[model samples]
Every structure is written in structure tokens, then in C-alpha cells.
Target chain A: MIELYESQRAMRNMRRAAMQRGVVAILDVGSSKIACLVLRFDGSDPSDENIGSLAGQSGFRVIGAATTRSRGVKFGEISSMGETERAIRTAVQAAQKMAGIRVDHVIACFSGAGPRSYGLAGTVDVMGVTVDEQDVARVLSACDVPDFGHGREVLHAQPVNFALDHRSGLSDPRGQIGNELACDMHMLTVDAQAIQNIAHCVKRCDLELAGLASSSYAAGVAALVEDEQELGAACIDMGGGSTGVSIFMKKHMIFSDAVRMGGDHVTSDISMGLQVPTATAERIKTFYGGVVATGMDDREMIEKGGETGDWEHDRRTVSRAELIGIMRPRVEEILEEVRACLDAAGFDHLPSQQIVLTGGASQIPGLDGLASRILGHQVRLGRPLRVHGLPQAATGPGFAGAVGLSLFAAHPQDEWWDFEIPVDKYPARSFKRAVQWFRDNW
Target chain B: MQPLSRKSQSARHDPAPSRLKYRFERLKLTPGFRFCIRVVLPFALSVGAVSLWFASDDNRLAFNQMISEVRETVESRPEFQVKLMAVDGATSIVAEDIRKILPVDFPVSSFDLDLGKMHETVVALSAVRDATVRVRQGGILQVEVVERVPKVLRRGDRGLELLDETGAFVRLANARADYAKLPVIAGDGAHDAVKEALALYAVTGPLKARLRGFERMGARRWDVVLDHGQRILLPETKAVRALERTIAMDQAIQMLGRDLTVVDLRLTQRPTIRMGEDAVQAMRSSNTIKAGGE
Candidate 1:
């Protein structure tokens, strides 16, 4: 617990330092690729005038961006520190060279780590005056931290809502006269070792780790529109090694989970089913991967060339329907896992059940229709928002995590560290408020 | 414990009907259509991309050339080129400065010019309060600027700077002589409190000839210094009312014309006056002489 607090404090100081330096790097380390974006801050805080709309417009610009094939990473987690560090260095160095400047601070996002969300509530008596910064801090401290078992650490602790007396949903409770001040905070916890490994990997790349966020949350921030973010939406980032799911409401991520199966599984299945090389299987999958098969597929044939020294065997072809048969079950399984995660998150209770599919694997032609049927929600394919100077290749759904990481670096949502928590009120194990928080929010 | 178990089971089973309905609705999509939409089309598109990749010897080069050509044609249109720039709502000197800092090349495509960045660059100038940049008809890049109006000439550690009505620095002046017509203020933070100084100056309009300048005391309140060596200490808040009262008292009793060194209006309830050494000596001698005469 003490280690968790120390890590949070260190991250906060690093974030402040990054903002002061006027330039920072956003690194998205995934199984398929490692992307780096150099963001130049104009030293203006994101104003509350437009709120959710245009939040990412005025604060930062992407001066440089670069992506390289990832190595030694599997399921969005660093499998080999040395290899991942080399890949990160390559990506970051290219971006820095293009940006014509060196950045020491970097904020990274990944899709693994088994993220879990908890809703915590806290209430405190306003210090007899208007609700001030100290009062808000005290209330945050008053929220009970749940026992998330061993080897787990908190990633994001955000104040999602504030209530002053009987007035609920106050975005900010400062300067308001109230006898009681209460807050609803969303806390996301992940495996501690997963974060430490990434931190160690980044340190090896000679960059300071300023912050960390789940890639699913980052994708939600990037792909969903303002209305989707406010009204409630689910973002499913289908990547090479894993599929990440996150739920957003009022522009804050309330729930997040990830499935270990991803597009790589589908490729592996195809390779095994067709007796082809992994590279050839990936190429065929990208060109012909679909969950639905039609009569036309049976007529359309794909040449399966091989270099086994048998000319006749090398020139053999297979019907596209056979390929579809190999791919559909894995994609369906991944969606079913996503649906289970969403159900566990109580996603149906939200006012809007819009599901946005993003990331590289989501480019499949009819995944949205299949996902809509399976997830029982209105589904749409999402790509990263257009950012200035972004290369054409980096505009695809594959770069959603990277683009969202840039936005997160520019205008980070207010977190627990931004407040001065009262020293006297350590987090208590009050299960009552936790239950009440779930009742009030869910 | 039995009741709790029953409640949990009930909660888990509650969504069965909705789940059945959803499944039934999804079953409406026939297998053939689903297979076509999901599998066949995606396979065809991927095969097409693969064929395009394998067909040409310089596929990447061709693609790059095509993209560049399309971009060039779109950007090179005459309507997109900014032939000239016209700066409005500024003096010739300020307009020249605006042009110097803009860093834009003539006959460049307007699409290449980031108007928001240009506006920020123009607003960074000390003389500009705000600026708006737009492309007009006939390939003209029009820039409209609102210049900060200088209200006071402040002489501080950084030398003389013109201050706006809000006490913000507008621009630097070479010397106080250049802006001698404007009211002068000195000391730290005087540039930020030009509003109060201007208000005091307004109230002392009748005595403008005798007023030399205003000095900021400790970055709070003000000291109105007169040419005849009289200093009026104004309170931090409601200094205008105090200045008005002082002016009224001076008009009623000729208080300012007397040889008073300081008028302390910091305590508004009871105003105190400090006499000059010579005036005190003269009063003392007159009182003694009157005592001797009696």
C-alpha cells in the first residue's frame, strides 16, 4: 500500500515536470507495433468552456510521430525487456529526430495487465465555509480503498462526480456553501508486476516514465465522439494479441477489462488449419479474413503458394469459404469474451449502449455486424481522430492507442494526485460506502 | 445465508428473457448473408490488396507519387494561394511589426498556412490584444487586429512601458519624454495597478498641473506626489472615495495650499496631516509671540 502511494506521488511529480518542459512523448507499446508521438504543449491549460467537445483541439499538437514493428511483446505485455526496450528506443529516437528535439519524459499505455474497476464513495463535512480545495481533498481521502488482493496496484483514481449538500453531479464543488461534501470516485487497479515490467523497460530505453494508462481507456478517449463519451459508450480495441474493453460515461472511464485472445490467435488458427507459414497466414488473413461466409466465397479461390520443392502442391488453391471457416470461431470467441466482460461491468444499465470497435484487427469487413449481434449493442468501427501532421499510415484504427495516448498526455483527466489528500484520513476498509457508491453510480 | 443465496441466484437469472430475445433477433440474420458480409467481402479486399502488392515492381513508389500529385493539384489551385496580406485596425508601425513576425511567404497555399498558429503569433506581440486571420476573395489573406490602448506611461526597473487600462503592459517606450503627455506612474507593480492610478488622476483633474506622478507603495495602495512636495497616502481599498474627500476638504479650507508635507488618508475615519519643518517652526514662533503679547 505504501509502495502504491509512493508510485502515485512519483508519477504526479513527473507529470507536472512534463507539462513544464513543454514537450513530451506518448508511447503505445502493443503486440503488433510500438508507436511514438512527440506532442508539443502550448502552455495553455484545457479550458472548461467547451467541456467534452473539442477538448483535444487547442492544447497540444503532434509535431512528430513514428511506428516500428514490435518485438518481444505478447498480449500487450513486454515479454522480453531487452527487445521491447530496443523497439521503444527506435520508435522514440525516430520521432525525436523528426521533431528536432529530445524529450526526457514519456507517458505510455498498454492493453494488458488485467485491469479491474472499483467505485468508491467518500463524504466529509465542509469546514464550515464554502467547499474549498482542502474540503475536496479530505472527501477524496475519506473514500475507502477496497482490498483488491495481493500484487495489484491502482492505475487511475478519478473523482467522477461531486455532490454539495443535496445538489448532485457538481463537476466542481469549490466555492459552494454546503454543510456536506460527498464524492464518487472511479478507481482502476491492475497487476503491479505488469506495470513494473513496463516501467523497467521504459527506463532501459533511457526515458522517464511520466504516466501510464490502459490502452482500452486511451482508445475510448480517442475514438468516441463527445456525445458518446457523455451519454455512455463502450470501446473495444481489438489488437494483435489482446482485445481491450472499456466503458466511458461523462467523459470518464468507469469500467475496463481485457481479453487475452486477439487477432494473432486468429492468424495462428489459420496457419495451423492451412499448414502455411505464419507470415503467409497473416497476409492471407489481412486480405481475406471475414467472420461471415457467402456463396460467392466458395467461388472465389485463393492461391496457396509454397516453396516445398513440389511445384504442383505449391500452385494449389483453396476456396475463400474454407478460410472464413477457419477465422469465424476465434473472432466469435473473442467477442463472446468481450460480451461477458461487458455484462460483468453492468454495461446494459448505462443509458447508451453504443459499442465502438477500434484497433488493427477491427478492420475486418463485417466485424461490426457480428459484434453488434454478439454484444447486443449498436456497434460502429472507429479510427483515430485526425491529428495535425500525422502520416497517412498512422491514421488507421491500428494507431488508435497511440493517438489516444497523445491526447491523454496533452489534457490528462484530473486524477487523485492533483488533489492534496488530507494526512489524517488514510484509506479505510469501509465496505458500506463502497456498496453505496455502486448503488448510486451503477 | 439461504436467503442471500436465493437473492444472488435470482439476480443472476433476471436477464434471461432479454438474453433470449436478443438471441432470437440475432438469429434472423441468415447464415449465408452473414457469411458473405463477414467472410467473403473481407477476404476479397485482402486478396485485392495482396494482388496490388505483388503485381507491380514499384508499387510503393507509384502510390507515393499518386498521393503527392493529388495533394499538389489540390493545393496549387489559384483560389488556395494567398497572393497578398492586408493587416487592418493597426497603425503603420504596428502593421509592419505584425508582418515581420508573421513568417508567411507570399503566393503560398492558404491550406499550408495554419491560421490559428498565425493568430497566436500575432497576439504574442505586446501591442496586440487579439488578432483574427482569414482568407478573403482574390487570394487575399486578411488579418484583423485589436491593438491594446496605452493608458499610462510606467517607469519601473525594466524602464518605461506603456500600460493598458487593465494595467497590462502594452509596449515599451524609449524614454519617458516620448510619452510625457500621458500620466506617469513609477515603482513595482505600478503597471498592474494602472486602473487605480488612472482613477486617482481623474479625480485630481483640476490639480493636474501640480501633480507630478503617482508612486506605488509596496505594490499596494498609492502615494500621489505633487510638484510642491506634498504626498497623499491613499488606502488600499476605497482610495477613490478618500481622494474625493481630500479634494473636497482642500477646496473647502485651502488645506493643500498650506505647508503640509503629508496627508495620511490611510485611516479614512480620522485624517492626519503632517506639517513641514519650516511650517512647524513658523507656527511655534507665532504662538510664542502671541503668548508674549498677551
Candidate 2:
């Protein structure tokens, strides 16, 4: 049952096993930081009526957490492979030491390249009044596995919708009475090599690869409010190495995209423009970065330290207006590129007008006004929601994706799990009927 | 129950021993089997015939008696009626007009009343797909039918017609219904092409209801119009997707205002708009020529 869905099977089984055994570990392998959290599933009450929250029955409890600054990674890719392997080992070791458990299976989340989308449709026939496991298997088998691009393999092909006879847009069509059942699935794919790289990193850390998630999608799960998710919303996560954009509708991520530049670029701009060290530039950005400048800022000056160890050079100062003039353009360009991406996504057609900005870069002062100007909508800064035992330090926008990954690992979206596998094919083709597809798949 | 009598006992077992005796007696009649049996068998058969009688055609075989009674009732008159002329492919044509078109095909005779063969003959014509002709009790024949409607009106090398979603071509000239609404597709090989022009209209539920025509711009794209005068431009790769995006965007931007003239989804994410006179002018130039032509 656990191995039925090709992508998330192991993770689902591991999560279930952890719940039965009372512990699970979640790992987030991001460019800026590597995060780990040990969760304890309290499934005695899976029903939400006792929880008093709109968020569906969340039965997981986090016991221990640790995050280490990531090293040996550049542009969200493994540049120094050995250094990356060592970094992952250090993060997992430190997390294990704190949790007091030798965790085996770890669900990982990462930001990188080679993200693609495909639409696959499968059909199955209903032979009786009540749709059984065989019916579910048949419809899943009938899906037309599209010819995804060469050199790329599918990572996630989950059924997004189901149709029964003349009725369509059914989220679940299992119990309905109809002669035919069809499903339209949206599948996400990534570069095979990128997946293998992450898998290798996890395997070297003495942990099994339970699952993988796009960084943008995980952050959206943590950042977006319920209404925003239902009507449609975009999450712009400005991480240290990359800025990820994910669009959600009907509480599911329909599109996930990332730009290769983010908060680090802003720090680099400040370092180059002010002729200061990288550390000092980061401080200045944290204290005084602004996309919009005030009239009084021209007279106001910030004390800048010189590169050398000379007292006279350390006394240098630059006007705040000058810093704004230097920083505003780069921020504007990033927003313009984001606008281009949104236009590419055809964002103007969404039903709502809300945009949530989260991440290290999004924390900069006046970035909201700048984003609203460029994205052309209502914009707000997003912070990670409070979950059981989430550390105060790990609750910031920078840790949104990591925290969301923890929650996601604990209670994943049950996508293709209910689709009982037929005897014939794991990825069923469109030509087979439901029962025959199930027979062939199983 | 009465006690068994001698006659009753004989009646119960009468045929059993006789059947055995009959088989045994046949063994002794070798010479008589050919000559004597032939003479005895005819006499036995005549005796058997006199005991049984059978009726044929029930009591209705007395029609000869009824014909003599009918002969005294009315004066004789020659059978006369108007002729029916049916045009090929006009399966739904009325029978009264057949006399006006070709007045020599129908004749007033009881033998000529079977119109099934004639109906089949007309339906065999290239212009006719199906038809039905029936004769009434008053000697007047009436016809009612349903004709095949052309699916698509195609124009490229020469004017050819299409039927159904199969994209099959109809060769007959002027066989299409008068008020039937069919799209005119134009391109190099668009005679039977099932591309974006057809798909864009097929997906959008509300838009499909008001579709007026489609103009194929080569094999790649389409520009279409709704009956209420809304125009749409669809892309090649994800035509259905582009349509869905357009619908979502329309709800968001309220771009499909009552005065909207054109909605374009060709540019990946950007929706180009044309309104007022420019939209009307563009629509007229693109859709006017090939739309309602005969």
C-alpha cells in the first residue's frame, strides 16, 4: 500500500511508521541553511473537532529542532560536492545529537533548477453502484502519461481532478455512481541529476531519502492564509541564494517557479557600491536598507568603516540617500524580473489580488511598497505560523520553507495515495480501462 | 371410481398389441409390398381422408362472394392521381410540393401505393442521407424527414463541405440547411483540420454557447467570434489552457465588460485587448468574408 505512489510512497510509509513508533525527522537542504526537526505523531485523535482550528487534523508534535548555516553551495547548486556532503553530515549529526535519536528516513526540501510541468489524463470505467479499490486503480491507470521532455524524469505525478460521466471538477469521485471515471492529473518534473544529487547527499548523511519538495511550494504551505489559498495567491520567498515564486489555488500549488538571485545579491550590491567588507554590508542592509528614500535622508548619513585597520579610514560616512539610490535600482530590477515571471504565469487572471512576501530579502524595510508597485496588488510580509515546539529563531520568514517542510513532512497532502495500484503499470497509460488498468498495475 | 368393465379394459390396451402385430404382419408381405400394397394403400388413404377435414384462409376466403356484392354498389371510374417529383437529398421535403416540382412521378393506383422502395431510391442519392414517404387513407401521400447537417464549411483549393466531428467532406452543392450554423474554416489544409480553432470554442462552456464563426490563421492559430459580438484569439500550444487563463483573467480584470471587442491570449501571459471601433473593424475584416457566405 505504501509503495503504490511512485514519488511519495516511501515518505508516506515512513510517516505512518513514525506515527506508529512515535517519532519522525524532517530535513530541509537549502542554500542558506540546513534545518532538521523531529516530530512525534499524536494520532490518537486524528479528528479536528477537538483541536478547534480550521487547519485540518494536524496530529504531529515537534520535539527537537536544529539549523546550521549552509556552506559549500553557490547559486542553489552543489558547487563543491565534497563540502556540501560534509555540510549535510554536520547538520544531520547536530540534529541527531539534540533529538537523542538515530533517525533513518528524512524528508528533504531544496531549491534548484530543472522544474517542469505536465498534464496527464487517465480514465477508468465503473462497473457497479459503489466504486471500490479496483475502480480507483482503473481510473488512475487510464491516465495518459504525457511524453515529458528528454533527459528529464517525472518526480511527482499526482491526480489533481476526477470526472464522473457528464460531471467534472470532482476532487473525489470514489463513491459516485457513473459508468466512466476520468482523472486529469498535473505532474511536476525535475532534472534527474538534481534529484540524484539531493538523494546522494541524504544517503551519505546515513539517512534514507523519504521525499523531496520544491522550496517554493513548501513555503507556500506555511505562508499563505486559508482565503488566500482558496481564491489564489502567490508566495515570493526571497531566500539568501534564490527567490522562489509559487502560485496556489484551491489550497494546492498549481505553479512553482524560482529566480536565481535573492537577498545575497542585495548584500553584494551594497558591498560593491560602498567598498565595504561583505560582513559590514550585510549589517548596513539589515539596519538601513530601503527601496524608497525620504527627503530628509539626503542630510542623514551613516557611518561606514573602511577596509583597512586605520582609524582615519574607519571614520568615513555616507548619506542615507546615496545608499537608497544604490540599493533601489537593483531591488527595482528584481521586482521587474518578478513581474515578468508573473506575466509569464499569467497572474493577471487570478480571482483574487493578494500577494504574500516572505524570506530574508523580503524583510528589508519598504520592500512591501516596492513589491506592491511592481506586482500590482496588495502585498504583506509573511511569517511562519506557530506550531508545536517551533523555536523562536526558526519562526522568521527566512525559515518559512524549512518550518513548512517540517509541517508538510508531518502531514503531507494525500495526493496519489488513495489511487490503488493496478497489477499492470505504475505509470498507467491512457489506453487501458479502469479495472484492466488496475489488474495490470497491481 | 367404477369397477373395470370388459369393454373399458379392451379400450385401454387396444393400440399396443396391434402395433406389434402390424410390424410382424409386414414381414409376410414381400410380393404384395410392391403391387398389392400400392392398390390397398390408396383405398386406406381414401378412407382416412373421408374422416378428416381442414380449413384454409379461415372464413375470409369468401372474398369472391363479397366482390359480386361490391359490383352492384357504385359506378366504375378510371384511377387518377397527381405525380410526385422528389429532388435528391431533400429528405425533409414535403410530399405536396412533389407534384409542383415533377408532376408525373406519382399515379393513382392501389398497386402504386408502396412508397418504401421509392423512399429508399431517393435516399440513395448523394444529396439525400435519409427520408420517409407514406400514403394516407384519402389516397394522398405525405413525407417527413431529418436530413444530415453539414459539420463544417471548408474553403481552400475549392469549396468543400464537412459532416460531423469526423471532418468528412460533403460533395453535394447546396445540401446544407438554411438556418444551420456551421463554421467556415480556411487555410492550406484546414478542410478537415482539428486544431485550436475548434478546441478553443469547445472548452469554454459559456463561450461555446455563443460561438458564431472561426477563422484559421494558417495551421497554427485562430480568431473566433461569439454570436453576441465578442472576439477571441487563441494560441497553438495550450489552446485550452490559454482559454482557461483568459476566463480566469476575465473574472479578475472584468475585461469582458459589456463593451469588450476582442480578447487575445497569444502572448503567453499577457492578454491584449481591442475595444470600440478598432475591435469592430478588426472583427469585420477578419470574420466577414468567409463567415456567412453560401
- Top candidate by lDDT: 1
Query: Alpha-carbon error at A352 in model 1, in Å?
Result: 0.9
Please give the range of 10 consecutive residues that has the lowest summed lDDT in model 2 chain B.
B13-22
Docking class of 2: incorrect
Q: Write the per-residue lDDT of candidate 1 for residues A214-326, one digit (tens) a residue.
A: 99989998899889999999999999999999999998898889999899999999999988998899999999879889999999999878999999889878889999999
lDDT by residue (B135-192, candidate 2, tens digit) is 5545455554445555666654654455444455545346335425555566655544
Docking tier of model 1: it is: incorrect
The number of the candidate with the highest TM-score is 1
Cα lDDT tens digits for candidate 2, A172-252:
787878888888776677776777787787675556777777878888888888789888899988887778888887777
The i-RMS of every model, in angstroms, reads 23.2, 54.2
Worst 10 contiguous positions by lDDT, candidate 2 chain A: A1-10
Off by over 4 Å in 2: A1-8, A45-54, A123-130, A426-442, B1-294
